[model samples]
Target: MKPIMKISPCILLLLSSFASLTSALTLTVGDKTSVCAATSLIVDGVLDYYQGTTYGGTIGLFKDPYYWWEAGEAFGGMIDNWYFCENDTYEDLIYSALMNQRGSDKDYIPSNQSLTEGNDDQSFWGFAVLEAMERNFTNPPSDQPGWLALAQAVYNTIWARWDTANCGGGLRWQIFTWNKGYDYKNTISNASLFFIASRLARYTSNDTYAQTAEEVYDWLTETSGFVVSSNDTTNAYTVYDGAGISGNCSDLSTGEWTYNYGILMAGCAYMYNHTSDTKWETELEKYVNGISIFYNTSNNNIIYERQCQQSGSCTNDQRSFKSIFSRCLGQTAILAPQHQSDIMKVIEASAAGAAQSCSGGSDGHTCGLNWGYGGWDGWYGLGEQISALEIIQNTLVLQYDAPLTNETGGTSEGDTEAGLDTNDVTNVNEITVSQKDKVSAAIVTTVTLVTFLGLSVWMVL
Candidate 1:
């Protein structure tokens, strides 16, 4: 038998509030009843943050500190729960939230969010619909655009905004010029496009979508030098944060986030699943190898945000990242089965850790942020709850069929140009920031923010 590790006074306090049988989540993998109970409990915890509960703000959007984009992810999480656990408890709310935010053009870009929303923001809502389309979830009425069409519209808009001139090619983080990070190109934005395109490729069987996914992958790794500077035969490429175009994209912000790595691995899995080609398989191996950096090996292989969790500085937006990462990692396990054992091991461990963290708050079930700490870390939010829910329910992934394709029982319909007017929604091209204007700001801004470019700048997003 292994000896017990002695706990410190501080650590004991952190774990004390959760010392209860009533509220702490508990789970065992491959047990459908256990998984559903855990997901149902945690799913309700996630919805507890919805502003709809208070009737103060919009019905679909979550309460503040949580932004509009993460709400999209929240609904996406519900879709996953419904599919895997066969739980329809939150379906109507999820559908209402999705439709309300879909902009006038029927894209995910709600007009109310136009001022602050960026490419990544819009793509997340698209990711929700993409999830809906791929899983053959309940579709909207005929008068409303189908899930596939809504997702396609978002894909088309972000694809149109792919800037070839600066940083060689990649989508900007912010959609509008006036936004703080407009000059920055981040992995989440580009990786999101890769995700939508790859899934679309599988759903549509269109070579164009696959080609688009490949191009974005190339730019992320090669041209932008943001993911990898060269094809490292080691397959140990570190996915960095982002880079500014002012220095011709030479100044790299090396802060790493879990979702950045997770999204790419997921897209690669989708591509491999579609083609059964070894190249995409190779790509998956590279990224899956790279995924180790996010895990806390000493703590039962629990996953945490490497950059910010330790520092206790993860912003409201950053807090929600693990939810996305865990969701995608689940996708990777489903689409690329070769990696299933390894991925599920981490997910299982993290889910147990997450279950421990959820034993805090008055409800005694509100989740804390860090899962590797053995118990609550005192940090709590919608991000924590959502993160816990995704990892826990994804244990049910193998019990269901892999995400559906158009020819493989998917019933969603599509429209090629469904959201073509998204540019008008974002108002990006309405006024251009000239090169001289861009370079002038980048010179001073880069020098001023050199030390904390990726570190602190994430707060604005």
Candidate 2:
């Protein structure tokens, strides 16, 4: 038994609460069902699986993207593209734009040339053609494609100048940072881009693209430690080099940290799935375990308590939605199912913390004015919420149907585990997932409508 130490009134109150729950209080939503199980039934709308869009109506974050990126120079070029402007569907358009930006290169013309007309954001416009071609093998539409095409076109033009040396090397500015006219590359972002590109290759079955991504991955892992810069801590890559706040890069540490590792982990997992190489797994586990140090406590409470205090400076602190969401999103990168439940708990709890901070309750799926912008026009707070809900939906889809398999019939571990044991009666603490009840009801409604509309349209055909 631990001795009770005297402390501040607030600390005493908090401690008392901890003592009250001597038995680990399982958060039950009712009927002793697992939190994941309860959340499973609460899908508000259908998700566009290929893209992370919600049906019924998108929350604030996915609604409009261009406006969100316009505020920041870092993402300015990428957001202003034809795919984003032309496709009115909110979530998909933004996702498409992000994908194009992540995979962009110079001299690489998008097969979809028309996507970049009438766009004023010149920096990212040119890359559109190459990016679209690389991903979809389709050209831009005849319509007035706005920001998406223009941004992509610009990125491609810049990428062409990138130096691919020694198995794989990245540019200094344009390649990884999207900054124009400079030629410096950081190992972290380059690794991140490579990871995203590799996943795209796996999804699209483009061997050449996959090979390029693999080469890039090889270079980064072989030459660089987790630390991207010499000044960075041992074995850890700084998110950026320019600013102390970003660990290895610029001043804003929020942009660097665990989230980058998460992206890299997910990418490596996908690469491992396609290449059948254990190296990817080894790398993934390293990052997964490495980021754990930042956790506030052994129980994962520190992550919640610290929230968005990356590297001490809260440069872009107003909207914690993206930062928190990144942490939760990273949990799904692991290929093992055994760890799913534990990961889900952390993701769900983090999301709940976000909602609890903003709104009084955990059921905050609806978007409103208070939700601040991040990657898209809608509030990142909402994006955080959507991410959590989508995880639940994705898990269910995998459980009921063995989806997420590679073309070679190899089972991808992506969906192998259903975390949180939604049906487990003994493991409480899953009550948070129950907050999704209304969202699930909305999903049922949307499905019914879609079914009716599809049948009607089919009959006419």
Candidate 3:
């Protein structure tokens, strides 16, 4: 009879930990698979086509037959999907679009013509590249420029063009003076800057980025009066559209856009992560509550832009707003896990509605602009596809417990630990031995056992 080998308590704990770690990477079965399928349909059917010119190495924008700015927005959405899905199939396409859209110095100038390309357009692409670097979708190359370096170059150009004389200290909507929207100092550009600065601060551990983020937030809320509390019963603090050049940067436009609030929420969340300041947390809560109050519909609880309520029609730009908002809200959830439940409630409802509305299309998965309504709104564009992809990706990340950075110094199956090196035993010892640590230790043991078994066979020879 074979004798049973006794397993130590330590070994049992380690094995348990290993099991948890392994399960974390495995995709959840039902909704995630459907979401991924929808994403593939959008990428293959809608976004892949060749235009007049190619820049980096591949064909034209992955999102074919769209405006330059919309192309940039779509590129961002696709990059986000790539990050969440952990695939690089779209990398060359993204690289080519970014290259074609860039200026001589990588300034992200989609077009040289005035009013066509603006700070917001450049910032969107820059934000996407920055996200790619943060998520490890792209890494910094030693021999050449990387995503981080390119993003910094774009930020430098934007800093050089900051309009201190006009709106105290904010970016103009357009880069050129002759452009049509040049006089409009919009919330999107400034909030994008704040988001970029906050992320750079976290990535590089630089206080200057934190300071810049704070400055942008202060200028928008205190100086420009773009941030206001809604007079309705919700009374949540909301970010409005920017003041025009005519008002001397005093009068704020009542136009409320989701991306403006979303960017600022993400910026605050990152600032909180970097500084551990409660002020940013307070701001985050305000934004989350504001989004809940204003964007969420009573009947379906799906997100919607208030300005488009009169007509079920949303502009090309507004079509992608909720996706951006969901992505940013997901970031906030990672930063403050306390808010994860609230954020998830909002995201899951929208994703469910989005998935349900994915019928009657030629592909049978083309989503619509209004997620609150039942049926497809007969609108099938790159923007709608991107929005659906974003919500789905955000839901996947949240449901799987995949935070971008592990704050607890614990082992996550598919996530990187933020504060400790996985290879260093000393750092591992410094961390408290939670269930996750036990699992991480089990991983270390498994590798060691493989090495020992290999050596033992060699010795037998």
Candidate 4:
């Protein structure tokens, strides 16, 4: 049963009294990490970091979150949580435990249960992180030189799978068939790939990448539109090898579509950011508007559910996935501040509350892990939490200040005249400084071990 949104007369009177407290809730920048950027980076690192640590491979660029449950799906099933077939690992929990244990009294270690099962929420959470870092780092002023080289490597891996069948306006499968070369195309995973590719194109300023991105994006749009278009339903409903395949191509899980919409909005934002292409921006606008409409009508809370359990009682009741969409909204706010109002406070609150809850555990590390579980349904590292934190921080910025303006009074990319609204500039600036410091600390810790290893090797020689 759905929880009713009822307000009693007495409760209403009490709410009125506390209204001042709510309105006075200032979103000042603090020493705390910015929820948006922090979470994105963490997600990227934890998701992919384990690949190098355990698998000796670059994280596979295209893999859907949840397709294994389908009756005929081949790539979905596995015996262990290591998920050797997909390079999944327990490293994320280890990192999270370390983050919390650092400079703390109680020793908090995630049980071996951390390696229990492979889930998509954690995958997408990580995917969102990597996607944002690669795209943002590759673009203009904040040119992270290291990321360029990294992007090249990941981009090549994605390109290796490109073929005649899945090349133009077709699905790109998340998990691939090694023997067949390149046979399957998972629609949901392909959506994320398109978004990632588009961001890569913007960062590298490569037309071929951009062109391919547009093709994939267009294909996904044509097919995924909830209301089917008259032009082409074939792309929308492409089957697995045959017309009567047990599970059709359009058989997408709600969780999959949630990530799909998120990356779509983000990819579109990146496209506009890099190309200044009105067409891409216009296309993204349609999705943002459409999603907002559907959400409002449904009273849907994407983060409130514990997995996709359709049962009366759930073993784990947690909130997940909403942060990805919220982070996407933050990206969109940066790209097009005018549309910020279109996203409701509920989204921001969901992201913020989830972040706070996740991070409020016994210590920072556990807080992060809990946040990951709250938002993604599995073990989380500091990196994923940092990414979500950055988004939350950015959302708070939009809510408290004007439509759009960084502390530098500089406008976002193409829009120079529209400055961020800062009613209390000093307080806001202080908050940003504090958050930046927290984020910088997290980055240093992650890279510290690698730096030390390199030094040790030099000494040995």
Sort every candidate by TM-score, greatest first: 1, 3, 4, 2
Estimate the lDDT of model 1: 0.82
Candidate 2, residue 393: how far the Cα is off, in Å: 6.6
Q: Largest lDDT belongs to which candidate?
A: 1
On lDDT, the stronger of 1 and 4 is: 1
Model 3 clashing residue pairs (backbone): 17-439, 47-62
lDDT-better candidate, 2 vs 4: 4
lDDT of 3 by residue, 1-461 (tens): 10011124454344434533431111122366656766665555345233423455234343222445666666777777786666678787776666656654455653332235577777877777666566655543455456666666666666556677786878888776545678889889889888888877777666766787888889887888888776876647778888887768877687888888888888888888788888888887788888774344565578777777447556666766776787887788777787888887777787776665544243445566666666554555666767776776787765543334324222112211211221122101111235565566568658866975775566445
After best superposition, candidate 4 residue 166: deviation in angstroms? Answer: 6.7
Better TM-score candidate (1, 4)? 1
Q: Could you tell me the TM-score of candidate 3?
A: 0.75
Please list the residue runs of candidate 3 whose C-alpha ends up more than 4 Å from where it truly belongs after superposition: 1-31, 48-65, 110-115, 231-235, 399-461
In model 3, what is the error at residue 42, expressed in angstroms? 3.0
Q: Write one digit per residue (lDDT tens) for candidate 2, span 299-340.
A: 433232133443222222223224322422332433444345
Best by TM-score: 1
Q: Which stretches of candidate 4 lie over 4 Å from their true place?
A: 1-145, 166-171, 174-184, 223-256, 293-320, 344-347, 355-391, 396-461
Q: Candidate 1: where are CA atoms >4 Å away?
A: 1-21, 229-234, 422-461
- Local distance difference test scores for all models: 0.82, 0.35, 0.64, 0.37
